[model samples]
Target: MAIAIAADELESLFDALPDVVFFVKDAAGRYTHANLTLVRRLGLKRREQVIGHGVAELFPAHMGGSYAAQDRRVLGGETIDDQLEVHIFPNRAPGWCLTRKHPLRVRGKVRGVVGISRDLGRPDARDPTYERLRRVIDHLQQHYADNVRMAKLAELAGVSLAQLERHFRNVFQITPQQALIRLRIEAAMHALGTEGSIADVGVACGFADQSAFARQFKATVGMTPSAYRRMTSTKE
Candidate 1:
């Protein structure tokens, strides 16, 4: 005979999974139910505080905007399968996660969204291939101010250029070159918080010139370096 779990038992199971965050939100994007993982990650003392709030009320503006958009997509009867994403915790830490969201249907009509996010631990510690990939990542992080060649990265990983690219895509869903750019941009962002000239920050981050840095930074971060610095400055 098949076994069936009761509703309360199913909820208890969700609460027991510490590494996974589970939540249900109404079509209007208000939280209806949230598991203990979500509650703790949001730094809430009780679940009741999260029951009626939306993402915008809890997360940083940019991250909250992204979540709100995804909620709209799910409510429109779309299912978002496991996708890698960067999530910001209430403690202001950011990490990679696998996120999935599906529409909650009532009488054949989409009524809300149900979602889960599981943290993906440090890339280096995950698998053998990932350990090799980590070597390349560490090298890039240390030498981001230098012109990093793909061949050098591949050689470090003991793989061909093509194999290195495939591994990066499989693990991070981004190419090695893209990862390099992301690293450079992140470094530049941190440097911008200091009292350095924009041109200096650009060059320090390995861009060929200030214009090139500006273009790439704007493309990747959705704002000019100067603007980002000013915005973050105000917050601080």
Candidate 2:
């Protein structure tokens, strides 16, 4: 005999984890369940405030639109796994997270979506590859404005490409490629706060061009570079 757990029980279990945001959404993209971490991040005091709302109702316009679009893809049967993202916390601070979303199937039919966004934890210094990965990270930070190659990173770490990827995920909870992208994005975000043109910033951040930079920035930060700059300007 198999035991079935209730959604409420699962929600409660997830609520106990302070660093993870968990949710279930119906086919219409309305939230059916949300953990406390998500609620608090959205600046809500109670679960009821989040239970029936959609992303559009809870997040800023640009970010809400991006999240809703992602939900639509999931509703259409796409699975998003271990996607690196920058999530906005309650005080408008951005934090790194790895998000996963899957179509919830029931009785051979897709019913909804279930997802989790876990906060990126501190890297494990005890991992044997930590020192090697540290060197790679240092190089990324120092040279994010230049064209970066995974093969070069592998060589720097003195490991095969496969081992480098595995070690990065094991220690940092992200791939070496993701680490490089994170560095570039961080630099771009800082530069966006200046008066420099978006295109120039894109190229200076090691993106192939403006379009690629805008695409990656919007995909990870949930807004276009100009929109982000405007928002940040308004805040300042």
Candidate 3:
């Protein structure tokens, strides 16, 4: 079922979301609202410029127009959940957006279509080595809590460990263990800063013991988890 929200309320909620979000109406095919991140990404000086602007307005004159018609189809009670598209953004470099289109209903009736997108920009990934390393890195980034073995990483990268190590160092300039440690430390840091729990933070980042986590965290960030929390708290 479509989420029950008045247009204004939904706009506020959508704008509050951390991801870049915006919506378009079927009738006029203009932007209804764009979140702060989306606004900055589009390089608009002011919010007024974003609203009432269409993709054709923001993108270069040579961009595609088929999506506008597709948006209209979604508003007519068809749901286009997630579609991947590559387009050029403000810097004239290629970028990716995981585009989601859903029907926006008013009073249980289809009012318009709303689109949400998450950007994924990785130009270096076109190279073979980088792409292989990226697939491995993505698993670690997204599933840090899961047990990730060296064999699994090599398998995902479609190479042997020696090859993986050589290519990973060449592309990312970091060893696999270093990458894992950095990822674990960053996850711990985020958990420590945001949520107040020592053990939870330890386990979330695949750390078995608080002492080990504290040691590595201190080594990587020059501060313990508790100290990091204190730092963030002081800044707050």
lDDT by residue (179-234, candidate 2, tens digit) is 98899999999999999999999999999999999999999999999989998888
In order, what lDDT does every prediction score? 0.78, 0.91, 0.67
- Number of clashes recorded per candidate: 0, 0, 0
Q: Each model's TM-score, in the order given?
A: 0.64, 0.97, 0.46
Candidate 2 CA-lDDT value: 0.91
Q: Can you write out model 3's per-residue Cα lDDT over 77-122, one digit (the tens) per residue?
A: 7887545444445664434445678886768887667778765333
Worst 10 residues of 1 by lDDT: 1-10
Encode model 1's per-residue lDDT on 8-90: one tens digit a residue: 35446789998888887887899877888888888887988988899999765655666787798899988987655545565
Superposed on all Cα atoms, model 1 deviates from the true structure by an RMSD in Å of 5.5
In model 3, which regions exceed 4 Å deviation? Answer: 1-126
Candidate 3 has which clashing residue pairs, if any? none
lDDT minimum window of 10 residues, candidate 2: 1-10
What lDDT would candidate 3 get against the real structure? 0.67
